[model samples]
Target: MLNIADTLYRWCREARPFALATVIEVSGSAPLPPGTALAVDTDGNAVGSISGGCVEGAVYELCEQVLESDETPVRASFGYSDDDAFAVGLTCGGELTVLVQRIDPTDQPHLANTLEQASDGVPLSVAQVVDGPPRLVGRTLSVLGGGSAYDGTLGSRRTDHTVADRVRALLRAGRTARVEVGGDADTCPEKLTLLVHTQAPQPRMLIFGAVDFAAALSQAGHFLGYRVTVCDARPVFATAERFPHADEVVADWPHRYLESAEVDARTVICVLTHDAKFDIPLLRSALGLPVGYVGAMGSRRTHEHRLERLREAGVPAEHLARLRSPIGLDLGAHTAEETAISITAEIIAHTNRGTGLPLSRVPGPIHGRVPADEAPAPSELLAV
Candidate 1:
């Protein structure tokens, strides 16, 4: 599993056969999402987690049994409402469908080759048939990025093509989902299925000023698993010593640097420089780019001024609407560290489509669903 890729590479290098268990589906408020995995070697060693802590003991023992029997590629379900007195289930309110499969290096050389990519950090999507007929279950199809050929197959050419198409689209969008095979577009959830898991390079978080807030926000961004970059026109301000957490510090003009930067659906940008020289040119392009988040640190007055300038420069109203001026959630933050927390909260809430409200106040899935109106204004994130 890509979650524990380095460990998998080491195991494969040692030719250690192991049993891999992955959560293929979840119902209710499971802490971990689908595609989370746990691995167990022949010696009963375990790596990674599936349900945080809810049903790990049972899943670990299941992995041990799968290793001993080697008759794996089996499915098991655990829930808190189980009637069996000695049943293993989640104490938290949720159910997990885990798929356990045996991976022997010598037995499945083709799969070992695929696992090797995990260590190299090459982007790829692995679609495994987690639910289907006995013959199709456990079958996997892998699609590697950079024009490389796909490895393995899901039984037939038609199935392979169908899964590959879905995987390619998901890879571009930096997403993963359960896809049905050998069914119409309106196929039910009970149909033959492939759990598609995508692995992309760490998404970019570009901070456009080497200020104190930038320093703290860069640390928060890195902690959130983004490859953070701090850029500024002033060489003295943009230095590794100043922004220790930034993956890269650039001393070029913010607009010029962003023009050449790699922008994707997962990229998020923060423009901390309120100066017109920096804000106007950089935001003119940033608001037009297809990034996940584009925010600016400023007061309401400054935001109004910035919007006016952007409008005068012929920036469309729709593009201006996408800009999250006065960056960060309205947490009444004062210090740079507090501001970083507010900003980071907004980023997380935006990414997950969260309500940015207290859990007690909200009555729905903890993990949010995509709303009909995909892009929400900064105020809409509050859900008042």
Candidate 2:
């Protein structure tokens, strides 16, 4: 749903009615995680996906039924049961619970506003009652940050208060979770299940070189939903005209720029500046930070020299171990575009904690929920 927020916002602004189905929960080896969504307009146009391509046809029919009959939100479960194997079962042998609801801007004002906020990259969460009393099925509440700024409400004030706090906790964790409220000490004894769909700001990819490979990698990073920034000391190479795909192009020393930039655990740093003067100082700053990846491009001999310089500069051996010299996967790439693919592949593998082995050789579930430390994909694509 977060990925299709722009499309949903456009539809809302045009007053177009649509049906949205979101994956509220999953068991076994589902392709997508819980907050993934699929939307179908009245004209039969669809955007986003919940189960890759496995159950999309069935989900589309479900959305059409909701829109045509104007039905209340309905929760449907699809799995690889022997009884329904020929029906809508996941080819990956997983189960998913989808909640389908009809949405109209005139009726769901809060939802429309939330979509707009999500499209603008504001960090927020939409807490919706997925299961409870008949009337509270689609009831929603929006909470931003830890503050009390909230819109919409559940039927009960106590429930809203309880769920708002939970939503804030999940937002802080940057996770989408299904929480059971209104049980025992909290509110009513009848438990209510709420799905908190959180939208966090995009993670960043800071490439410290404006070479041809950096240009291609910048485009690849953008396609992967990263806010990519290309930086270099040479103004002639770091111009926006050269790296058009980057969200920002800065002409500054790599170490100085990174020292002042906003970096987090989700940020990735790529050091393509092969020169010792630039690479050593920049890597010293990056390897000490909490960023997700720090890969430097160089040959095996260059890697040894860089490592010696890093150790001599007082960088600990453990910190130097975090640096990926001779960066990128073993793709035998020569062209700039192929080299970009190799680098991005290594970044994705590192972020996901993947082994960089061929999928065909890997055992166990082919698709699993992304780990907490990995960068989350848009609702429209599979995280893998």
Candidate 3:
């Protein structure tokens, strides 16, 4: 697929009139989510996708009309219907709305720049006019260089600053939200679409254990699209020969590694170092911070001992609850490979908070599974 942001930027640079179509809202079996966007130029060329080929052709026609029109950004709906007419409806019985508008070259320089940054794989949010203030209307604000700074405005400094700060935090965690500000504070109604881009790539998973189980778990984590780092304090065990699939195999103390490193909610710190000598101090350092997942592998007795040790060390009960003792779902896994699946499943369940049921059980449209041949090439994990 073409890079949507880059395509739009290049079109703008070439003085080409284009319309950006974004799936603003979706319900029931949507092929694309709310933030999914597509760009279509006057030449019938397009990038990105609003649907899985079901609605793209129809949306393209609308984009072409919007590009040729003088009307402002407009919201249009598309959904499945049983009227024996309207053959272009979604076959999956899903509904989606597309917000199409001509890119304001004069007002969208900053938006273009932010889109350019996004093209470089740095995620950003572009808040343009769906229909609001003229100056603030079609403005784009981007959070880059690790702070909230934008090239344009939303007319009001108060609203812009508040939204930027809140949006930046949400973007850091790869989320998109639509905010309606100025409830009682102002006269005009401002509708701002906050699309928080995952500026950086996927989150990193540092697995500080290179055992047989670690190999299986690391592989499973890789499938979940994490940059896996397998480290062990023992040099003999921490070798590329054993875990050739791991992204990083470091021979370092787990406690020292975590203590000096920068960590956030996106980073997962899994301490499979079954040894209390190694696990205790590592847990001590990890619990002190807001790391995403801190799971330690141990039995009921082992966790009991660890709990007492943590309490004696003055660690609060609330903080101790953050740790997932015994690690992984109760899958009754016996072998190392099976245990790894359970662990990875638990991680997914925690991340999505899924009910762990069959997809058929849910009332939604079934999407075609991505064939194995079309799947993304696996990154070489020999080195990070």
Candidate 4:
């Protein structure tokens, strides 16, 4: 899982034999989604979670069985309908398909390196055969970036090449899915199900003001698992002491710093510098980029003036539509901490395509299903 990458790396490096249970598929009102993992060691210790709390005891027992027995990877299904078959059932009426496998460091040495790369914010994907022959069930193959070279194998060389190509395509698109392979004439007639888990670097949140609200928002971003950066032209305010939660504090003009910053479609830019000199140039650049959210802090009157200035600066109408000048949601927040919460909530809502509406008013599952074509947005991975 994303939250336990570092811990998993440590366990792998220590050569500790552990059993890993990963949620490969979920439907209905499942608490967790695919790619979430739980690990159990020989000592009965565990890290991470698949279900919020329900079915954990049963999953832990299954992990223990994998570690103690000679069973191949086990595909366990739990749901309300399976109550008769499985004593452990989800109370939320959701169905979950999990793959439990014993991981030996000696057998899968590349697993440690994979975990280490993921922990260090390198994008990669791991494809594990979960269904088919018992000998192929636990086999894993990993592809880093868009490179053709892959580590490990899924039984035969032909199967490994096929899985690696699919994984590379998924990595390029930044998606995770369960794909079936090896049913064609060139390959084995028996199809095997492979659960591909794509691990992308954490999304970044760039706050271009070092005010008190910016400090609070930086901390909130950190809590939401964002690699936050606080930047400002004023050295005194942009010091790391002021924004200890930020991953980096830089004293530079917002536009100039962003000029060389690494950004992607999942990046969020918060322009808290209310001044025209700093806001206009920085926002002009931010609005043109393909970032997820761009918000600027200001009042209604200030928002209008900013719009006029942006229009005069030749920013397109569509680009202006991307900016949230009033910044946070309508929380009636006055304190910096409260404003931070409001802003963070808005960011989460935007990432999930939510209307910022109350859960009581919204229908269907509270968690939205992200489109497979899009990158794994921050809200999708957030353990809310």
Best candidate according to TM-score = 1
Where is model 1 more than 4 Å wrong at Cα?
1-196, 368-384
Model 1, span 1-384: residue lDDT tens: 678877877888799988889899999877788888999998888899998877889888888888888784878998876575345677676888999988877755556666678568776778878878776677677777421347786655545555665665455445677876555432222347888887876678999989999999999988777899999999988899998899999999999999999987678999999999999999999988978899999999999999999999999999999998899998989999999999989987776556677767554333313232543554655554
What would the TM-scores of all predictions be?
A: 0.55, 0.53, 0.55, 0.53
List ranges where model 3 is wrong by over 4 Å: 1-3, 128-138, 186-199, 202-252, 255-384
- Steric clash pairs (candidate 2): none
Candidate 4 lands at a TM-score of 0.53
**How many residue pairs of model 4 clash at the backbone?**
0
Cα lDDT of candidate 2 equals 0.83
Candidate 2 wrong stretches, greater than 4 Å: 81-86, 145-148, 184-190, 201-259, 263-384
Against the unseen true structure, what C-alpha lDDT does each candidate score?
Answer: 0.79, 0.83, 0.69, 0.83
lDDT of 4 by residue, 98-171 (tens): 99999888888888888898898787888878788787787778887433358997666666766776676566
lDDT of 4: 0.83
Residue-level lDDT of model 2, residues 1-384, one tens digit each, is 776999999999899999999998899999999889999999999999998888999999999999999998988998886766667788678999999999877876777888888888887888888888877887789986332357787766556666776676566446688987766543444578888888765678999988988999999888877899999999999999999899999999999999999987667899988999999999999999988789999999999999999999999989998998798999999988898899989987776556677776554334332233442333313333
Weakest 10 consecutive residues of candidate 4 by summed lDDT:
366-375
Which lDDT value does model 4 have at 251?
99
Error of 1 at 101 (Å): 7.0
